[model samples]
Target chain A: MSILIDEKTRLLVQGITGGEGSFHTQRCIEYGTKVVAGMTPGKGGAQVFGVPVFNTVESAVRETGANASIIFVPPSGAADSIMEAADAGIPLVVCITEGIPVMDMISVHSFLKGKPVRLIGPNCPGLISPGKCKVGIMAGEIHKQGNVGVVSRSGTLTYETVAQLTGLGIGQSTCVGIGGDPLLGTNFVDVLKLFQEDEETKAIVLIGEIGGTMEQDAAQFIKDKVNKLVISFIAGASAPPGRRMGHAGAIISGNTGKAQDKIEALSAAGAIIAPNPAEIGKTVKKSLKY
Target chain B: MKIHEYQAKALLSQYGIPVPSGDVAGTPAEAKKIAAGLQGKVAVKAQVYAGGRGKAGGIKLAANADEAEKSASGIIGARLVTHQTSARGAPVSHVLVEKVVEVRRELYLSIVIDNARKMPVMIASEAGGMDIEEVTLTSPEKILKAYIDPSAGWQDFEGRKLAYGMNLSAQQVKPAVKLMANLYKLFHEKDCSLAEINPLVITGDDSIMALDAKLNFDDSALFRHEDIRRLHDPAQDDPFEARANEMGIKNYIKLSGNIGCMVNGAGLAMAVLDLINYCGGNAANFLDIGTVNNTSAVISAFKVFTADPDVKAILVNIFGGMARADTIARGIIEAYQQIDIKVPVVVRLAGTNVAEGKRLLAESGINYIEAADFLDAARKAVDASKGGRN
Candidate 1:
């Protein structure tokens, strides 16, 4: 019933023997994600959380029939790991590693153009299809299986929004953190398209911050294509212009990518705007009621 | 990751793009020597990261070596505040002395990563000396863009088309095309986020030269380019920001506000600032503790915040998913143990192991006010910043 993932999703862990990879793999497995294989060069025979480790993604995929991969490789090797996964024919690759160079992403983005693969994030929290399968690192307890679909450019704010929805007895079909990097694999438009088509997703929540024209572009898509109820919130209303607010992508250059601009655009496109993060639950509830 | 104009020009020159003969000098005597060594009248340009240095009197013409020394002394020891920089301005540590070129035409050229297209784009305009963003708004036709596909590689024809579109004369066309290609190669080879030559000038002798250069490196890609990383000048950065970068804290920007904010993600960290302002308080700084919420990292985050004398109160908002609230709470306690924090503190913890996190904070005896939600926490922080009792 979920959009990108469900029970049939078989996961592969890249950089499985590393500190972040090994730790989050255990959490994902505990959350009931089918993590069948792990890949770490020079540690091929090792087992992390009972998952078999291989030296290469190609070997990991061939032996385990792993369809998806969540990469926890360090920033230096993340691009190579992603390309390896793509070369091995993994349909879905979620890069949880942060601090990847923009130039590296530019090359990766170019290489993935004609490929049959979808990359979620190079600096994102990854995606979770609640109660069915979790590919990346999100707190498992806060999610419940329902119809609401969430996509955000943030981590903790996404958690806050989902928690509010869960608190209001509203569960989600899938929640995706598209990452806070300037260049991302899957943007707001891509996720909105999926949410629009997924039968389980009757409502969608989009959390955007200052930076990029993605939110404006997403507003256009929502106006043209999306037929479902959408509740949105744009952060960084107080951020100064020309200053990068934590995220590389969260800077407002010139008159573009301002919070007010995004807010007005989304509002003009008929998307319900949550005044703040705490108001998302009520806004979504109200939108679904109408 | 932004290099000085001198450093950027050196990089451009290395790629076969012509630049005025210049050398960087840390002292006025050195600057005078560099100017004396040049063939003609020298221009003493203050080496700072911010733009609009010309308007800020950071750039001055010196007719002689003595005048060059005076210009260098006036600029090197002074802070050059421009519209692009903060009010305090960036301190000038060096002066770039170069042979002044004969007047001709000024045109704008830059290479940047376009996010929407997910590609490197070269932008050129006939009107180069003015702000390109302003030109893009007012006169869109004056600007020309060429999207570069790394896989397909850049073609010389694309450069020729851009050079022609920029209205360069036939004699300037070949050199302009070659310079464009070299700039693209340098941009791609160095993994630069932004490489610009504002006033990519046509001199009186009909020669093409980069009048001003600016290069911003991709911080993430610096691992592969250790040589590029070596060009980093900590003197150009704010002291707190520089210190934070040295300590492995990537996301820390000092702002002129009273409430110190420490949040997990960048988006939420900014949201925290907005919420603080919404509740009628200014955030003193933006500090994202990052994904690995360990005790040492938290301690470092607290140190960066408390180091700011303007931070009247502290707001710690952690919505844990991969970063657990318990881990953050432990870090907060550990930070309080090591540092003396006098500001009123308010904390809001939610999501994973939040109950345990709140309990840990309650037991720490640090006298922190716990709020039920985001709005309440913000209100409390704002109130605390005004010297209100928690």
Candidate 2:
């Protein structure tokens, strides 16, 4: 009933032998996610947290029938790991590894065309389907199973919002951290489409940040398509206008990708804007007449 | 990741793409010497990371070696403040001294990764040297675009299309197309976020030359290109930021407010800034200690923040979402022992071992105030920023 993942999802952890990989793999397993297999090229035939390890994603998918993947590979190999997962027919791929090169992502995007895979992040915190499954680095205790779908570009901000929402007795169907890189696999519009279709997601909360056209494009998409109540929050309102914050974006995109501009866009699109990060859950509460 | 105009020109020339005959000069004498080699009139342009140099008086034309010396001498030590820079402007340690080309026509050519398209795109406009954004508004037809498919790569036809779209003649079309292809090659090979020729001029003799160049590399991809990394000018960054960069501390950006911030993760650091602003105060800087929470990094970050004269108070917020609060407390304690912090520090801890973290901080006798939660901490930070009692 939830979007992207559920209780039936079988997850594979890439780079399962590494420090972050082993640590978060245990965390994901502890969160009740079915961590069926792990992939670490040469370190196959091993088990971590009682999950079977495979040498390659293809074998991992073939043997364990792992349908979803969460990559913890370093920046250099993260892109190839994504392609390997996609090539192996893993329908859902979440890349938790941050700092992947933009060109590598562009190449991955091109390679992913006509493929069945939907990639979530290369520099993101990944996503979670509360109560049922978790496939990211988010603090598991903060999320509660409910109806509102949450998606954001920042990890800690997503946790902050989710913790706030959970405290307000507002649960989420699924929460996604889409990551904060220039070129990502799945953008706001792509995730928004999934949230809009999920029947469990009665309302939605979108958290965005400054610097990128994704929020603006998401606002336009929300204006044209979304039917449910949506509360939007954009962080970095107080961010100093450092170079490349938008100056180059100004020359090319005309839009500076500023907080005020994004806020106005969201508001004009009929999405109730949370004035600040601290007010996000309250704004959603007031907007939905809860 | 942003390289100076001279550096960008060097990369362009390396790829067989034509640029003005220029060499960067650290002194007026060097500039005069470079200009003397070019013989005729030369242009002395301030080598800075910002744009709008032409309009900002960062660029000057010198008819003789003496004039080039005067121009370089004027810009070398002075900060050239453009609309792109803060009011104080970027300091110019070097000037690009180059031969001036007679332009038969000016056109725009650039290759940037288009976020919306999720692919690399080539944008060209016949109406160059002017704002392409304005040109896109006034005459949308003037701005030509060729979206590159990463797998297939940039084709000769796409370059030809751009060259012809700029209304180049039959002979000029080939070289222009070649230049476009070379520029694309440079962009892809160098891992550049942006490779642009503001005025890709058709000279009086019908030769194509990049009169001005700007290249911005992907900061994340800098590891792959050591050659491009060598071009980085540390003098370009703020003193504190440069220090943080040297220490390998990621995402330590200086802001304009009085409250210095130290937080975990970029998202939370930004949220801290928002919470500060939302609480009726502003933050002085954005320092994300990252997920690792290395004690030395915290110490270095604290050192950087405390050194800023603009910072009146410090706020350290750690969500501890798989991170331990006691680790942060130890980091803070370690930082306090290593450095003499003159400002009030408000620490907010969440997640496991909060009591232990609190006890450790309280017993450490560092005088850091503790708040209950994010809001409480933000309020306390705002209050302390106003010189209020703990």
Candidate 3:
């Protein structure tokens, strides 16, 4: 079985009346996700694509038994939405909003400490369990039900890796975009632990970019505890130092978060390294063969 | 988003943080006047966005006012090519002339968002002036990190622990604690992503001074700080990048290649660039249209990409998961009609009424290549480039 989400997971949509929120909520419903309720602060009595809308997350959770919340709020309201979901006792919160202030995330992250709820992203594409449940803004048509588990910091890079895997006739158990912010709710090691425990996930593919020591920490985790066949690809191989490549988290500062250093660390930890994004799935397939 | 040392120090001084007396000089004459007023030795630092200026001969120690003037003349208009700066070199806009203090001890201090810990972290090290990475790789124990809770104020005990771990003297511990507290204040108040004081030196008479400071403001929070917005130096940035920022388009970095990529989302833009490189084609630039569904942003992106002489082929990849795929397609077609683009255009559209998007592209009759998957799109885009048939 996949981790975090499956067919049994009932979901709620926060900010569901917004254009993006309504559109993606409809897509998720069409993709067979159990979207029990939608929450828009003032539009409580309304319905979006036949899904019941409520004013507050607590009401939606209480009435529909929606255990998870997917937030489509804008950057300014993202932190409050996350906290509202957390306070409502939703088991998981997936925030698809990008460009939330770092200070806002600082408070959100600290508030999440020792809490039972798992927070996914403030600037990331949400996670998906292929063919079962979909959350966030990733294209549902590109994913397939398979055994390979994918985790990445980059949303489009995750899409590329998944598309390649689907092309190779390999499906993913779950694909998680942990977001590209400097302060992510979850780390590579946290996701690796879930992937390692999933029996359906025979092999895992990690797509990382330059910046941060998350890869190094993940490499160390794999070196000690992980037993699954893992293949990884770290982007920004030739990226210049100190320049932030697209994502706020993808900055190369000092010597801590270079691609070469990440590649070396992952390689030394017995993980196959795909130097290019195009070869990520192929490298994972090759690793599984051996 | 990287502010120069003079700007950072000026901000720090405004927040009551102790920094050496300094003035920014755009001309050699101004530098000489400032150097004359300062006692003893003065440090002339190049006011560019890049780091490692000292190694590039952009930073020089002047013994006298005449020497400072000479150093300023040498660095003011000269380009400094450091490992951090581009090969084209970063043009020196101004020079910061500051009083040189006699250092009794040097320490490294910074407050940055720690991803793994998911908090604002403070890093302190006894070894300063040199790179902190060298110290981390060789002897990680030299670096002491304190993860601060945003809800609670900067814990004095945490600062004391870090101060003791860094082997600070009794006289230095109080100021170090105060510095860490003030640094956290600056980090939160300024909405900074990173606030670093490399070589936070202790003077001979036991006063702590921020010798060099570097601050990177969070671009997302720029709307809140108008003062920080005024310090932006467009000359230190690429013209196209500055224009992209002004238009509210996010991703724009100048690369030395031939294929120009205009895509939606940061990750997709990077993946497209990576795919271009993998296919033996170089990407000239990275341009993300962000989340805008407007036609003007699309037209602006196309205009910027086509303006580059090195761009031989343009790749437009939009997944349109939340955004309407057909809207992007319409924008692309509208841009092609409005702008004069000489390069071959490769379009890839997916998600949320992709058929409609493809239909819009078909109606354009622009002789564009369409692909179903990312690989096909990347391959087709690369193939359209000169000598990329293989």
Candidate 4:
């Protein structure tokens, strides 16, 4: 069984009337995600991709019993959508919207603290339990139902690693894109905790980037608890200091979040380090002795 | 985006933070006029984004208006290279003329989004006029931090606690507390990624002032703050980057290399950089095409890449998630048709509708080299750059 989602997962699409919202909703439905409802403020009653739409998250949750929410609302409204989903007692909320003001996230993050709901991303690809369900925007064709669990801070990099793994016949129990934003709902440590506890996840692939203390912190967590073989890849090794390489979170500020520092931390923590993106699947395979 | 010191000071002054009266001047004569308006010795500061300007002679204490003019003439049109800047430093075209203050003590004060904490944190140190990171690395105890919970908001008591921790006197506490609170408010209200007062100086008259201001707003959040966005000085940015920014292609940083790499997602873009380097090639720039690919953006991205003379080859790596591979392929083909690109192009497409995207690339008859995977693409791009096929 996967950690966060499976065949039983009933999903809701926030901002379902919007272009990206409607598009991904249909894709997720095609992948058998069971998207039962959609939410748009003004055009609530309008149907999108054959899904029932409601004005408010609470009403949608009440009518359709949608347990999970994937937000495709614009940046300005994405934070409120997350709070609304959480307030409505949706157990999991995955925000696919990018460029939300960090201050908005600061308040939303504080609001989510001690709450029962689990939040995934403000700038992420969301998560998927291969063959069981798909959420957010990751392509379903590249995944296979198996034992390795994958967690990353990026979207396309996750796709790259997953595709390579799938090509090598290494199927995943679950793959979660925690997003590349600085202040995300779920961090590497948070997702790693879930992967460590999952019985089906025999091995784990952690894809991180250069920035923040999340990787180092997750390395500590892995050292302390994770029993499964872990192979990790940290991007931005060729990145210069003090330059943000696309992602709002991916920057080496002073000496804090350098690639070497993260690599040293992870290697010291008994996690096998993939030298490059292409080597990830092979490295994981070698470490798993398969 | 980072604003000039004068602009930051002006914004701070609006928020009730005490800053010395300053005005920016683009010419030496204008600098003299601005300094002539201020009393006592004036500071003629070069208006560039890079730090360590003082050591670079970008900042000078002018005794009179004539000296201010001389300082401005010496600074403006001159590239001031600091330790923080590239060897070929940013050219200074403006100077901020402000009256100097007598400092009894210097303290560091800044409000930054602490990524690890997932909250806005105020970092204050009794040790001032020095790099906070160095201070943090050395005497960590000297760095006092207070995390401001945005939902609960920052309390006056928390500001007062921060003031006390910075060792403010009884008389200095009141203004310091207010200043601290104002800084936090400005940081939150302005959507600032960083609002720093390098030397929050206590004057000899027992009053505190922000001697220096360095405010950086969140580039992504600039859509919300139109006024703050107006403060962005494109002159401080690389010319090509400024053009790219105006074109709404925000994720482009020009580097000094030969291989121009365009890829989807930041993490993967960076991975491509490493892969290029690993394959014995240098990357000319970092460009993330984002999650959505359209023809115009792709055309603009190609225009920017081709504009750089250092670029010898271009690599287009697309592993679509939310992004469609066919769209990326089509954009690349259309961009190639529109632009006169002399550099070799290596295109790798994957994810949604791979077969369709591959077919589109093949049908274009553009002689675009195809890569089997990420590694193949990187290797081909590097090989193509070296004028060889491997």
Candidate 5:
């Protein structure tokens, strides 16, 4: 079950004693990632590594039930700690804090309307499912469980496309960065409709870059609902066109945010097109010919 | 971030909108003493930061004050080319002399922030003084929109429902909904990622005004607008992206290509400018240096592409998640022992301390080149920018 999180994802950190939240909450508690609780508004009974902190994400989700939070809260208190983790219900918030302010993400998108919250990234670099779970500042020994889900927008180009799909053995069923901000809280068709309802994701990839239309709306939701093997890649395909550095609604919505207009809209909505950024994991190991 | 249309009509005549009586001038005798105290036809214009600028003559029209001092000496110190600039044009200096208004129609107004409706929209049009992407590609109901709801705010009926969906004139819809609610309070007290006016005319004494203004702001909220960063001009950028954004390396940028790469992560500096232009070379700039473990902002972005003479071949590309790799190999050997570079760099270093950042560049005696990843550092920085030595 590697989608938004895994291994019974408890998490919750929200600026837990600062400095990139106890240094990526001690590498998300050494990558096993249950992390539990931390908050730190007034340094509530502090403790960081052994977890338990709480100054309120409503007292660390009523004493550590936590249900997934993250947020290293800076950039002016990251939209009020993402509406205090969606009014302390935190059904996965994420936000690794990078530079908030797009009018505080349009007031955290009108306070996450119709909120049964999902949020994910104020600036980003936050999810992971490999080896069950991990959150935020990536590089947990370049991830590995297996299934190839990995979405992106670029936190170190999703750790160089998840360390070239865990060095070709191809392992991930969940990576998601969704950050390259121009206002975001999860996109690329909201994590490609959760990697098309992930059945331990058979194959996905997607990396995308250079100003939005979220990869032509994730190539029309992977050609009207993905059936599996995807690939994709874009990453500013040598961004050079009369580079007016972006948007007048891309000259009024013809959206030439280029990269061969998102590689001809994800190869005419069927996907599979890594064509360099060193062939994203050899175009998903030659399209799942694994 | 794109001001000048006389700093967007001096911040839209300080929020009460109605812009027109101008005054920005660097010669042509102060644009003929501001077009000899306005009144009739004037508008000299040309300020830069792209946009058609009256079909690149960078706007003109005068008639008095010695034809606005011969239209500010044919747009002060020439260089405008515009199909939104960069066929190496944009330099002009300053002009803006204003006072033309006599239109009677034109409408368009803007605002921005829609990022797939995360909201702040506005857009509006009446097929305005041409181009709102050709009125949404030929009258898509003459482009009018509204958005705003920042948790129930700015709802003066979303600027009177885009001034009654842009057909105004019920006494111009309450001063065009009080000039779009004081341009949404000067686009929310000047964080302004594009406020624009385009035409927003009406005039010939019917009042509406702002015949073209522009705005933009929000370079990450320009540190709470020091009065919109004193109308920042930095000679309209690209002096190596305003000296790599004055060395804090706000993602450096430049680009004409000679391979400069310098990564740290703006999505791995755009996948090292797309695998160094998909391995044929041509990257010349795009610095990134973020994910701050600062190595002196990577030795001031390696002295900004080793002081760019169209950089010959740099690369560097560090991954180092919390950035270590021997502190970016002692700031690229202290910027190759305090600059005097000549290009050919290449490096590569991966996440965290990659084998003590490749054994401190194989016990330094630096002639760099290392590679082994990112497609062998983009095919050895596109074969060291095609045999460097420039």
Candidate 6:
């Protein structure tokens, strides 16, 4: 009943021979993700955690029928890996790599236009279907299968929210990190649309930070189309203007991209503001009760 | 990643863009010589990696070589404070002396990676020499924009169409087309995230020239361009940010606050800062440890925090799902032992081997506050900072 990924979703590991790729792939498999294939040039015929390896994404998809890919390639080659996955016609691509050159994403983003595939992140944590399947580097032990759908821009804060939810016996249906890059594959509005269509997702928890108009756009979409009870938390309340708050996209320029502006917009749009990351689960529960 | 105006103009000129004939000089004598070579009225521009230099007395007009030398003397070795740069001002290491041109009309033109559109976009405005964001917010219709095709490139026809749409003269359109082509080439070749010409001025003879330039390179692509590596202006950047980059820790920018943040990922570190602010606290700086496997990075992070006198408290938030918590815990312990920290530290450790990590922290006998969860940690950090302030 989870959205985007679940028990049936077949995953492919890009850069599977690398230290991060191999380590996370094993963890993902241990958490019950159906990792069917691994892709690393010149390492074709090798097996990582018993997963079949292929030289190219096309060959891997042809042999294993892997419809989704989790890429751990370095920033320099990340855009190429994303384009290759899109070309292979994979329905979903999650790029875990960070610090990708903006110019590289400019080309990759233009190429993905009019394509049916969805790109998740360049500097983001991958998605998880709670206890069913974990396709990212998020702590799987903190997640559980439940009715709440979680979507966020921050990684550790997502884990913190998930841990709090699990502590209160409120599990998530699906959690997606749209990433903190200025030009991300998915946006809050896109993931919200998916969560809105999923029947298992009763209430949603959205974790946002300072910078960009994505939060405002999400609030607008939530007001018009969202039927589920949604509680949100916008971070970087006291962030200084023109300063990038860790993430490339998290910069407060001029009057826009301020946390207060985003909080006000979301609050006016009928979203219960958590005010802090620690209150996300409790805030969602209160919204449900109301 | 932001380069000085002279560097940006040099890059633009290399791509065959029509930039004013100019040369950078490190001293007043060199400035006089460069101005003499131009053989006309010249503009002396102080070289600093920030915008709004024109308003800061950084830009001066010289009627002759002697005047140019005086202007360079006034600017060289002096800090220029612009609206963009802080009150402390940016020290001018060099001056760009260029031949002045007779201006007919000024128009704004730039190509930037539009995140919303997810493509390279061309922004053209009839109103030039002003901030583009203000133009976008006040009179968006005045800004004509077109998304470039990544594979097909920015064709001359597209540039000509934009010129005609913006009501440029027939002669000016030719140079505009050439400028657009060169701009796109420079953008791709230099791996620039942003390349802007604030006042693309049309001369009396109908020739177009870039009067001002600003360029931001992609930090991830620095390994490829050795020329850009040489242009790294550490004077224009925050010392903490530069030091963090050298240590492989993701740290940038410093803020005027009392609480310092140390977290595993960028997004999470931002969230922690936001949470601190939400709880009535201010973050001294934004720091992301970013997948640390070694203790040295942790020590570097500690050194960065301790170096800031305003940092009265520190918050450490890590979700070691990919990295083991015990490893991070050991790193933090090593960092604590290495540095003489005056601020109280609050630790919130989660994920794999978290219990062992917490146990190690407990055994270290360091006077640190431990929180069972993120909320408690934030509350403790904020309260401790407030207490210290009192």
Q: After superposition, how far is residue A18 of candidate 1 from its true place, in Å?
A: 1.5
Candidate 3, number of clashes: 1
The residue pairs that clash in candidate 3, if any, are A146-A171
lDDT tens digits, residue span B106-221, model 2: 99998988877779999999999888778888899898999998888889999888888788999999998888888888899989988889888999999999998889898878
**In terms of docking quality, how is candidate 3 classified?**
medium
- In model 4, the runs with Cα more than 4 Å from the true position are none
Q: What is the lDDT of candidate 6?
A: 0.86
**What DockQ values do the models have?**
0.76, 0.57, 0.54, 0.81, 0.28, 0.70
TM-score of each: 0.97, 0.96, 0.90, 0.97, 0.38, 0.96
- The better candidate by DockQ, 3 or 6, is 6
For residues A1-290, could you state the per-residue lDDT of candidate 1 as single tens digits?
A: 98888899999999889888988899999999999999999999889989999999999999999999999988888998999999999999999988888877888988888999999987898999999999888888889889999999998788888888998899999999999899999999999999999999999999999998999999999999998988999999988898888777888988888999999999888899997766788899888883
- The runs of at least 3 residues in candidate 2 whose Cα sits more than 4 Å from the true structure, single-residue gaps closed, are A242-254
**Top DockQ prediction, candidate number:** 4
lDDT of 5 by residue, A1-290 (tens): 87878889998888888888998899888888889898877888878788989888988888878898988877877889888889888887988777666887788778888888988866778888878788888888887888888887777877877888788888887888877776777788888888889788888888877665778888888899888878878776676554423211112223446677777888898888887876688778877878
Q: Which model, 2 or 4, shows the larger TM-score?
A: 4
Scored by lDDT, model 1 comes in at 0.90
iRMSD, per candidate, in listed order: 1.3, 3.1, 2.2, 1.3, 10.5, 1.8
Better of 4 and 6 by TM-score: 4
C-alpha lDDT (0 to 100) for residue B238 of candidate 5: 75
A1-290: candidate 4 lDDT, tens digit per residue: 89899988999999998889988898899999999999998887888878999999999999999999999999988889999999999999999988898888988888888889999988999999999999979889899999999999988899899999999999999999999898989999998899999999999999999888899999999999998888999999999999988888999998878999999999999999998887899898888888
Runs with alpha carbons beyond 4 Å of true place in candidate 1: none
Ranking by DockQ: 4, 1, 6, 2, 3, 5
Supply fnat for every model shown.
0.84, 0.65, 0.64, 0.88, 0.71, 0.80
